[model samples]
Target: MRVLCATALALAAVVVPALTAQAEQPVNLGSTQIVDTVGALGGQEAEVESALNRLYNATGAQLFVVYVATFDGVAADESWATATAEQNGLGTDDVLLAVATEERIYDIFYPSDFQLDTEATREVENEFLPLLSDENWAGAALAAADGYREAIEGPGFPWGFVLGVLVVGAVVIGIVLVIGRRRASARHTAELADLTKLEQRASRALVHLDDSLTTSEQELGFAVAQFGTEASAPFVEALEAARTKVGEAFRIKQTLDDGVPETDEQARAGLLRILELCDQADDELDRQADAFDELRALEQAAPQTLVQVRADAERAAARLSAAIEALRLLEQRYSSAAVATVEDNTEQAEMLLTFVGRTASQAEGAIAAGKSGSAAIQLRTVQASVAQAGQLLDAIDSLGDRLAEATQSLDAVVADTRHDLAAAKAFQAEATSAELSAGIAAAEASLAVAESPSTLANPVARLERLTAANQELEGTFGRTRDAHTRIQNARVALDGTLATARGQIVAAGDFITTRRGGVGETARTRLAEANRRLDQAVSLAGDDPVAALAEAQQANSLAGAAISAAQSDLTSYQPVGPSRGMFTGPGVSEAVVGGIIGALIGGRGGGFGGGFGGGRSRSGCFGALGGFGGSSRSSGGSLGRSIGRSVGRSAGRSSRGRF
Candidate 1:
């Protein structure tokens, strides 16, 4: 019975994973001609879709255009496009063009029985590649459509085949060939310029990685000395892996630098490889550095941290009575729903403060007994508890202020919303659509609710409802608005969106900062990207409020994602058992090592440096926001840096090449 059960379990495990994989396969757009998931075509999606549909009707050969972020972890662009085509039951009569905007790569897929000849296919790709390289996404889609149509229709009868016409045509052809040669020369020059820039970038990345590795090595030595070899094994392993990557990067650079001729493609590939290696090395080093920093802080800064935690706890405890009083007052003035978020905040604060106190005492005992690892863990717990307690107390204290602000802003917002609704109604009166009518109705309902006396008790909720409704109305009629008016509206919306994005980013940063022990690269990367986007939003707010609004929204999304990723990481974190032969344990050793290395490296902050935003440059801390460039960084693939491929089953014939 045991053998039978074991066999069944094994089979189930294999089958379950297979089923899951199958279920997760990428979905194909059966009839949709344009899939702009990344919004790369902006508002021109309809225009592009129309062109593609026209081409399909004209030639009976559908051309599916897809734009995505980064192929969603797919390794090959062609494979992904081919898989989609196969899934859609497409064959020689159809083509799929998949573009990953973030990765800056694209592929064209068709079946073996594809209608177009090889030259025609090449011509179609040529038509769009230049536009794509220029980031003219809409233009590229249109160009592709036109190119396919032209290929299918072919040139009309040679009317210039008469004697005199043929002579004129010959001269024209000669002139065209000369112009083409000149253009080709210009293109070659441009390509070389781009390659040179990539080469320089690769060199800079290599230097940065090399410097990081050196600092990490020194830190690793200190860690080993303090914690012993066994405890510092992870860092050692990470350092070695980083070194290996650096070595490969250097080798590639050497080959490129050697006094030997190489093709432009070859050199570009080498440079991209160097950058990829550096990126990978940096990621590995950053992860280990974060862990090391946490370990070091607990061991070396335990006393100070413990004191801080205790101080915070005392302050939170002191505020508990005031918080309770505030909540009581709010409850009298507001409904249960309005005060519910903070009703139990005071009690929770009190309990957390008590836990902090107990943890602090245990941590002190552990510190005194030279059990630094245990002390560090206990100190971290105390810190977290104190922080939570402070948050709870603050929520109680801030609720009334928040409500007051919402109430104060509600009247003005309501006025603006009414004005917007008037404009929407005027537009709807001109030519009413179901979408516009629905939006107008929703706005009216939301406005009515916002003005209700009962809803006044929850001013924040009312404000949110009104804001959302107004936004929907604006979206519905935005295209009809004059450019100036649209910009004015966007300016009004941008401020609130920016504020919300900033708050979310700060909250996520705080969470990750406090509980970084379990946080991984994904959270850090998202946080960095959020900061970068926020910065961009701020910069663009004056001139391009609409773009700024979009950027702010993206920043808010990224921040939320960061928080989610961090929470997941923390949830999955598993503590390792204590290692032998250390002063306090592995934790203490890591702290010591981190401190020494940080100092040796002149306390240069870790994690992507200030390239993200104007964040602090703290050693081993999530400081300098801009260094990693997050999703902005070029992820090297077959087409070189910043290029990506899609992952999908190999089911159709396709040609993959770089733009």
Candidate 2:
């Protein structure tokens, strides 16, 4: 009795737990039109039923969407859905979609009549999973039902239905191709137009600057002449110098206007040069204008203030010395040309300082001798010297800034060149030329030299050399990249062109079927010819890309002509000129042949370069050239005279650029 009691307890322990665990598992809602054992559908059950019913009526395909809290966490949702579908006696045309909301898992099962592959399943999941994740039970069910309808109603494979399927397929592919190509072409055209507009904008700026400078010179000449004293001589000299620089700018502008840029390189170089020259001249003219304003103030000063004038001259001379020293230091770190400018400018400034000191001494002697007339003349001379020294100081103080700006510009170019070089090198790893690598190396060395502290004493030379080397590197890298991209795009174009041509031919076949009652014998003959041409294109696609493109073009042309004829037969269309398709000909035309030959001979293949060339102008020259503007000027020298001088309004801020 004791042994039997122990055995009964052991059996009870196992059986009770199994029964309890089964009860804990999610309740299996009997297979119905829409099962929601988890109450996921809630208020949307009617909507789900309506959608499934409509889909079934339209496509003879049914979908069952079921949601449960969990499939016991062990059995997959797919297995459950299969069992539910089978239990419900769902036919081969039915599709089952099951979700275990709590477990965050879902699965879809396609019946025999609904063929599916990995791609189709992936698409279905992509569409339905998001809705499920959002707890959109009704939406998920409707989406599943819609997907099933599309799959069933979509073109199917069968010998008897081949014509209808092919015709529909061709029409759909044609629409996609035409829309895609048109969009791509529009984008490409916009890009090209933008580049053209950049060039135009630069040209317009040059012209405006030229006109403004002309007006500024006239105003400056008038002011200098009105001052009419030795103090005004420096202002006059500056005005002449500015005029000369402006003249040179005009010559460059004229050169740009004389012809359109033959190549991208030529265009970019010319446009950038125009901008640089115009900016330089603008700066020079601005300095001249400031000097004139100062001179006008000095002219109105009283003769009794000779002492203060001498003191002002002395202070300006000291500032001039400090500025020259700064330039001498700047020379060490920048390019040679930049340092040379500093050296030349500093030398002139020193000569002016010596003049200022001599004039100051003469004015002091005159004041001691009590000759006010002589003192007035000497002080006026001092004021002119001071003004000249100040101009020189302005240039010196800005030298370091200009050098930095130029260096930054070159660095940007170097960065872009290297990026392109890396791409080209990657594409042409074994084919990379020694010259390209050498250019890159030299550019790096130049940049290093420019950046080194040792070069600070002659910074201008290093900066100039670095700029030149980087520019050269840019040219080399650009050509290499263009070649690589051209080849790649050309190869891609072969496939794209063939596909587009085949699509057009298929569309023509579709058109014939849609208008079978209206299509005449001529339309049929042309379509037959188009089919033969398309077959030839396919046969040649592997061996000769160029020939294949030509054949494809011919096929596309013939198909279009046939479609046009069919349409004319359906309606009373007035006869236009001879029907000429995009590429009308029995054989490859001279232009097509020539284009292929040129692509082969040019050694750059074809297409709009690559990622580098696609929209380089938008980021290259203009973005790098921005951020440089005129420096603010100090208040006009504190001349003792309270003369009211009207400083001419600046002719608009120099250049307008967008980042």
Candidate 3:
């Protein structure tokens, strides 16, 4: 009974919607020994009818059979069979075998006190279900009739009918094998095409990175000549590291192009390796290029750059007051945690602006005193401070917009969560598992909180809560859903997840760009990785949405870590003194130099490595002693009450499932 309940729950999750949609009016069997709605028994209908008549004569138990395209909106096969049986006034000695051919489901139902209990009925189903699978419909019907006869009158098995079924089954098996082969061939062709595209992409990336490296090498030479070896050493090291990666990529390419044959998996791995190496090389080169560009700008136009920094500082100062006012307004409407990310943004911006002002004054004095080296250092400090201040101000200004988007997303996810709860309830109605019931109750409680008016004050947190609750509910029935349903659910969730990921990535990227002076290698590395993953998610969204959703969620998490790491780095950062050297500044490591340089030189140039590639009836002959029967029962009884009772109780002694 427990097993039957669980199986019903599992099948109910998947088949309910389909059953409900295709449901028609109740079909009344009404003394008909055989009702083949779709002609499932073919030309042997009379033979199957004859067998049923023989079973009735040998044992007074009547067997009523009904075949339809589907259960006509009934939630389960057992329920449909029971309704049809009772609707035709089938008595204590009667049995009903109902088949929904299109759905590949059938059930055998008899009175609870009938001679054939659950185990006996299971035996009856085992006799005919295999023939049903072979589409020997007439054979299946005959087998069922014989099974009932054997149960009542002792052994008289039909070996002749079994032999005929075997012949038909062999033909079906051969056809299935041929179809399987064709599908296998199609899959192989698709794999080959994918491999070819990957290889081509890797080759293109290798060529582009190689060209960019060459150009970067020339730029590194110019920097050394202009700034001397000590100042240019970091760029030199960065270029060497990039060259090492590019060289490795070339080796993989050469191996791939060699005469040595490789398996498709091996070739794919090699191609991916090539792409990975190329991306690493480009990142290394760009980091150095950015640092080099900053050095060049400072050295060539210190006075002009100092003027620009001052102007930027003045503009940021003007925005600081407005940002503070906006934060205060937001604070009144939301909780501290809701606006915590930007609560101190205005204060940070004001402090940075003051630091910039002092630094700029000192830089001007140094320039007046004809101390070029000291002035360059002071100007660089002022430049970085002004940029950080602008970022702080921007953060405060953007918080309201982010909150608004979160509120909208919260609404959408709440609706999705409710839909999940409805499905879980449907499954619970069929099986009533304690675990499933607890999950549904928990999710419903979460939804109650999430839908409260106060939840709007912290919409982001509410969204997370609702999403988590929905996920827990999904886990309860995740294995029960068909692949198509699972994929469709993923696609629906993906849009919001991707939007969240993109928003976080953009915010983190802007922080890194403006405050790179304080951000360290780890944060920058994570940010880059997040961007790569987000690109991959977008590319895979149409074809593999489950994978895409995973990737997007990962990107969101990584971006969050990047934001935390960058914020921590900024808080602990100390402005380097002029004594550290003209080129050295806070947060500027060798890898950072390489990243900046790579960006300056490769700036969206075309080529392969140009950017991150987003990657039955049995007929029995009538027995000689078989006699025909007239109508056995009136056809006036309603199926509604019988169906209601079946739905109300746990399934009883029945053998039921898809063929």
Candidate 4:
């Protein structure tokens, strides 16, 4: 604008004198009227007359064929024909001048209100409109004016020039606005291009993500399929399944940018959260994989325990497993005892009958040898023989009864013991010899009892005086053993039932906490209480047979209550299948193997059986009966020590193989 104004001022100064010189010149238009569109009113008539004479004096606008018309009939360039227009410095588009002669010509330009358009406007030296630069105008194309042959010129004025210049000013402003708009449009175009590129990239990433997710899902499915199949103890397969899931999840997460940029940070944060979840899953999978690796490594094993390594972790299942093994050993021991008793009874009955027969022969020989004088003595000896025979019969009968009772008890024990050991095996399948000894002691009392003649005797009557005494005694013992087994079974059953219930309570609490924050406190408290109950149950559930049964029932009831409460709290308690898997305590197997060894070396009475002496009456004190005298027929098998040795040796071999 400043440049335009300077140009306008320079042009105005040069044109002012030319116009003054041409002011008196009258254009020969052949009689036509012309009204100025922009000037000082009709003063244009006089002003043009004066300026034309002055301008024509100095320039060569020979003949002008000016056409006259109402101001409305004039074109925008008519502004230049006005008197004040030249003084205001007209622009190229705001003014027009035409010379009506053999050399016809025209010119046009604009003049701005700000007086700034003058610089850029092209100008001509001629006092007339130059011949049209378009090259198409002809002298003959001009129409003759009205019939008077008189020279005519229009009025020049400044009345509407301001508004005309204002219009021109608006045009320049419009140009500026248009330029600014185009700049904004270019910016918008560039932004759109960038956005398109980002969208395409995001789309590609999404496609890859979809593919990764699909692959991960398939891997996870395959892993899950591997679970609960033919996998043996330690279930290495489960670990494998989890490992696959974690590994895939990790890869899926790694594809995302770990160093999130600040741009789109919320979305980046969401991606990061997903990555964390993937990491957690991956970690869990790795753990499971490690577990399986350990388990698979254990498939190979050896058969016996070396002295120094007998109690080592690898030498046995380690703790609870050892206890379970011990209980199993106890069953084996008692069963073996029953078999031994049966064998002993068979042998004892034969020996007693043989003694009885020998005594009769002795009695007959004595009678014959004595003659009349020794007859009475012989008869007394014969009576003594009969009494001895009855006593032998009674002893045989008692032995038979004890054997039957012991056999029956052993059967029941073997069955229950098998089941308990299996349960413990699922939880923890290893322990040491010492642990086995403890489990065995818990399994049966009589198996550990030292033999005593007083406890063994039923001395009220002679055997010959009783009918089916052996059968009767056997039945009695069997009944007693059955009763004791029933009680034990009840207790074990109760413990299992309650443990299951307590597990349900813990699950319910976790569910509630996850689902509903409002009920979290209450649910957590309930879960804590339930956990305490379960812990207590673990301590005493198997202690008292009857109490264990009650505890089991209570545990079951609590489980239901916990589940119901969880559902009420969060509406999310759902039954899970095989939901609870028993945890194998880290050292349970080692303890079991240890207990077994303890039981073997220091049996219940603290001594090995069948020492060196002939059979003697059983004693009650630990290590007393086992000192020199051999054990009686009522001995139990020491299965714990044997099995412990086997499992322990296997475990040891497994460990050494790694070395």
Candidate 5:
């Protein structure tokens, strides 16, 4: 029991110290030197602090090295480091390297704000921890600083050798694995669906990325040759970046193959990352290639673009000269509104020529400076200016032609007006119709207005007025001639109508007189009125044929009515049998009675003629004197001749100059 208790006490002593050690207080970091905390760094302080200061200056980060005889914590080295950093009020731009000398444990705590990648952190831990485990405190400190510097500076050496080493190692490893697995003839089917496809797609994408990088390098080389190395520097740098990205893609692919991740999801993720890198690299390569191609094309086209622009400018200048000269001539010789129009257009054209000259100069300078796109833009401007100058010249010529046409039209107007006036005067002299006299007067008045001095002051105004006058005179003369012919025809028609009315009146009077005892007072009165209307027609015929025609028509109607009435009365007065002889007769007594009634009605006809201060010629009464059918006999021939002479004389006196 004593031996067991002693043994137990010894074990307790050991266990209690360990447990207490595990619970020891974390160092008060602020109370110590921040650069070399715990004072355990000793003579290595300057070297370590210098390295850390350099890192801070380069990366805007602070570095701290913490040393302790021992630390108490179950957490990882980095977790204590983070707690120490936070308790000490270390900023986010700070880094802490915590070393526990007895435990051979070190932790690199990055700031919560400034994160370091796992690969670099693992590399640093891997490199420095070995020296710490060996108890080489100074050497471990130097290694930690070196590791941080190396991590910050990147691989510093060329990656090509590393890539070669990895490739050779992978090939050797793959061959060994294959040979050892060859004895197992059984093939394992793939468990996942997308892993094989993912690997293949990743491989293809890497190949495409390599191809794109190679092509971009070649194009960049061509651009350098064409545009000089100085101008192609940016493209070269971009091509180099693309090539580096391709190498990164290859490394990621190799990682997938050699690492052969434990899970299909991990394998798929690796392949996807590789593919994404390849795509990004490909985009950069394509962008750089396009830029190089564009630069080369511009370099090749610069001189020709300049030459074309200069030529266009010269042509524009020539066109402007021509346009200005034409405008000068128009201003000097033409008195047209178009002259002012041409002047304004020529000014615009001249300004365009000036612009062309300046743009052509700019194009020449751009060609000298090797900027073909700018030169091309200026050349287009020159071409547009030349087109505008040509348009302005065309406008000038068109306006001149219009002015010439106007002048010619003015002369034509004057000549046409004179010809129309002459025709109008001739028509007036020959026209005997009273209706045409007023029309002739109106035409002459229009011509006088056209010939007025005030109207002739402006040629255009004169032309307008003369054109109106010419149309009026021509129309008036045509109407005057037509009126003369129409009135003559009307006169002839009136003569015929009057003659027919006289015959009808005489027939009615003869019939009434032959039946005087049988005819009633109404028949007698209608016959009297018919003779009076026939007399009025004879008076009106020579002066107003239209009025004479109307009067003649009325007389004809009255005569027809009188004849019908007398026939009806005679028929009514006649007896049905032997007693009808008391009302009507065909004897000398009836003839004597008709003769007396005819004398009375003839006096009434003469009175109608006398009231109008006109005497009815014998020819006018020939129809009445010949009775119903008198003019058909041989004895009536001389009477007919005498009647024609008397009618002709009366017409000569009445129609001498009336029409």
Candidate 6:
């Protein structure tokens, strides 16, 4: 009686506590439709995914955990273990999930590097994050899961049937097929595994597309924010481009939404490709945005380049103003600079009229005081001012006659100035040449005294020594020895020449800057322009960036034209025809081949001396002498001069280019 009583008490003890706990805690009873992943361990076959779903139904066990695997028949199978979570209405490895149990919460993830247990029979229970506080299941969390599963079904999937089952689980998993979302009278969806596989593939693709769209939105917003105002035009274009792509993506997404519409693997692949295009468009839109920003920056820099040009123009204007001031001083001597500037320079010839009507006798006796210069000076000065005012002006050069007369009075002064300039230039040139020669002499002297090829300052001798070294090296060292020696010699020679040429060139530049004065300025301007053009040509000619020759040609044309115009000096000289290369005598055509063949006494290639005789010979000989055929006179070398002379002669009769 005592033993039986003790056993009874212990049993009662266990039973009472179990009842108490069961009363306080909630049970997460899941739909029997889903299987238990841990059923082999005596766990419940139906594991509650959401604590709220169980509590709402009021038939669940506490400590709800979603089954990584659901038992198809109250037990896990090898085939079911390997099956994707989506195939069983569970979450994919990549999906994020939230679930609540009686006492805890979980989050589930599938990183790329994740490894699944192949050997352990226990199904992987992915943890989902909780969205609840109560032990009893919240209805909201279950509602969320229902919508989430619908999202995987896509608009085109049999979502209505799937939702019906998730709603009450007694909308039997089998019944889900019997009354499809679109199967109005057809009774049920096809539940074949093959069809399910196709559905899963489409679901995965849609998921990827959704994710990419979210990324696109974020990236595009970021890019637009970065652009600022200067990017308005390009930003608009890029936005339009992206919008078009997004529309295309929507079409593809719609196709995907027609869930599992494909009948075969090929169709699946095609659908995947469509998704890929969407991804690609997304990437390209972002890339194009970057390019657009760069282009905008380039446009902004253009204004800066223009500003540089304006600054250069202002400098040129300043120089021109200075030259005009000097001209004002020169004109001040004759008449009121203001009046003479307004009068016809030759109207000062009216002053000459005063002289002419008076008499040579009166003119000869006129002025002795303050007349240090010739009378012609005063006459020319007056004439120049008058002519400039356009009263009696003919041509700018017309003033040359009066100018000569005036300058003749200053012959001694000009002579003295010219003498000084010539003397300075001579000394400058001599000193430059002397310094250069002295360096060369020293090098040569050193070269002459060297005995050994290796020790010599002469590069060729050094090279020779290197060659000997290479010859002696013979085995593996030969080529290396020769290369080293040659490099050393070449390096030495290059250094010497560069050092000696450096100072002479520098000194010559000094003289150019000092003596040439404004000419240096003009030359510097022209050279700089030329260099810029050359650089532009190189930039244009770039293989990927631009083309080389075309850039070079454009650069050359710009620089050449500028230099040619600068040479004509429109600010000083009257307009002249564009300068051509050295002018020379006119051309006579000659066929070199014809003349040579004629000398060989062979064929017409030698002209008249060749085997061909009579008319052919005469024609050949004449053609050879003309150096051309078809009466197309050769004119390249002497063309410029010939044209100049002809034009000048014609100008004597009519308006044309003279010099």
**Models sorted by TM-score, best on top:** 1, 3, 2, 5, 4, 6
Q: Rank the candidates by lDDT, best first.
A: 1, 3, 5, 2, 4, 6
lDDT of 1 by residue, 425-542 (tens): 8866765568778888998998998888772278888889999998888887775455557677899899999999999999999987765534555566778878998999999998
Can you give the lDDT of residue 510 in candidate 6? Answer: 44
TM-score of each: 0.35, 0.33, 0.34, 0.16, 0.32, 0.15
Off by over 4 Å in 3: 1-237, 246-287, 290-302, 325-334, 362-384, 397-659
Q: What does candidate 6 score on TM?
A: 0.15
RMSD to native, candidate 3: 37.5
For 1-659, candidate 4 gives per-residue lDDT tens digits of 34533443343233222222211112221111122212212323433433433333322222122322222334654432343224332222122233222223232322233112333222222211232233222321121111001122233557769898889999999999999999999997886676556545544544544454455455445434432233222334433554464455445445544675434444444445544444454455455555444332321111111111222312222232333333343334344433332333333434444454454444345445533222222233334444443443344345455555654554454444445444433323332233434443443333222122233322112121122232333344445446556676886587467767766876775655444322312334445555665666667755566555555454454444445444543342221223111211564332233223223333333222322222232332222222221121112111211222122111000000000
lDDT of each: 0.71, 0.58, 0.70, 0.37, 0.59, 0.35
TM-score of 3: 0.34
2 versus 5: better TM-score goes to: 2
- lDDT (Cα, 0-100) at 10 in candidate 5: 40
**In model 5, which residue pairs have backbone atoms overlapping below 3 Å?**
432-659, 433-659, 575-580
Instruction: Output the better candidate (4/5) by lDDT.
Output: 5
Cα lDDT tens digits, model 5, 506-593, are: 8988776655544544456666766787888888877777667767776776677667656655554422233222323665443234
lDDT over C-alpha atoms for residue 255 of model 3? 88
Residue 22's lDDT in candidate 3: 20
Ten contiguous residues with the weakest lDDT in model 4: 650-659
Best by TM-score: 1
